[model samples]
Target: MILADLQSRLRIALTNTLVEEWTLFTPTTGTSRPSARTIAFHLGWYLRQTVERTWSVDSEYDRSGMVLEQAVQFDGDTRHVPDLIVHQRGLLGPEHNLLLAHVSVDEASGPDDVPELSSAQALQRRFGYRYAMLLDLRLHVEGRRASVTPYWQWATLEKGAESPEPVAVYTPRVLAEITERARRAGD
Candidate 1:
């Protein structure tokens, strides 16, 4: 599948899984919420499950062994570590065998988190990966109630550019459409 299509499908799968399978909030003394690491783990798990369930078995797309804090080198010298890297199965190394670099974000994330996205995008440009995705799980705490909103941003490599441009925003309606499409395709 193409990059956009894969991104759309994955977004749908993640949103649905988050809404249906998981509870977002737990009671705590002072505005407790899910940490970025916890969110990342759930995202990775659901992403792998969705890919396995929806994609064709013959496609040979393996979402296993998603590494965390993987150090990658580019430009012959510079090295950067990203939060998570998803690549095809049987790839020899991660330097050039990345399918997507997922940057996780939460309420505490800020400008410091941006460099990771840039680094992932740079790697995508150098290696011609389909896209890089940022998965932001924003939590809002009010009194005793907590709410979470999930945002998906896709960066696609633009022609002749060194880094990717924000190509699409995966909103709820788009995600719903993609989910329905995936269901129909599976049937």
Candidate 2:
């Protein structure tokens, strides 16, 4: 798929997840930061609906059966499992590895602190994915309520480039509107 089309579909999936899965951002109980995996699961569900049915959308799927020599080590493991991936299940090449995404929720870290961006780049280089993205959702918990703001950056490795280009899923104004909608829904 083309970059613009993929980006458009991603935006729809994110918007749907933010609006429909608002509860995941705000818990009625203790105010703990939301889980990145949990949010990615929801986002994957929506993304699956938007993408072509032939592509399988999965999370933490590391059973591709291919040897990753240059894979980044994390948490004492050499295997790199992306938070989300879109690809054909049996094939393991650039033609099949369409996209890979690393998801995170951080309240104190800046974009520079996001190590997932590096992981994304490594996975894209190793797996030869056409696109790799880092979805960093910033969440703040105040008492029983929480607020979330989403940001994303992507790299188009189709041309064998290593640098990732930052992309905004939502403009500042639209992001504020989405946050307000979630807050009102929670209230």
Give the best candidate by lDDT: 2
Summarize candidate 2's per-residue lDDT along 1-187 as a digit string, tens digits.
9877998898888888887878787767345656778888988999999998889999866765555554444322444467799998878787888888877777464554455556666778876788988777777767666666676788777554334554556888998888787667656
Q: After superposition, how far is residue 82 of candidate 2 from its true place, in Å?
A: 0.8
Please count the clashing residue pairs in each candidate, in the order shown: 0, 0
Q: Compose the digit string of candidate 1's lDDT tens values, residues 16-43.
A: 5555534443334334565555555555
Model 1: colliding residue pairs: none
- N/CA/C clash count, model 1: 0
Candidate 1 whole-model C-alpha lDDT, 0 to 1: 0.50
All candidates' lDDT scores? 0.50, 0.75
RMSD of model 2 against the true structure: 3.2
Which residue window of length 10 is worst by lDDT in model 2?
A: 71-80
Off by over 4 Å in 1: 24-32, 52-80, 92-98, 114-116, 126-128, 157-187
Each candidate's TM vs. the true structure? 0.58, 0.82
- Candidate 2 regions exceeding 4 Å error are 27-29, 65-70, 74-80, 108-113, 159-167
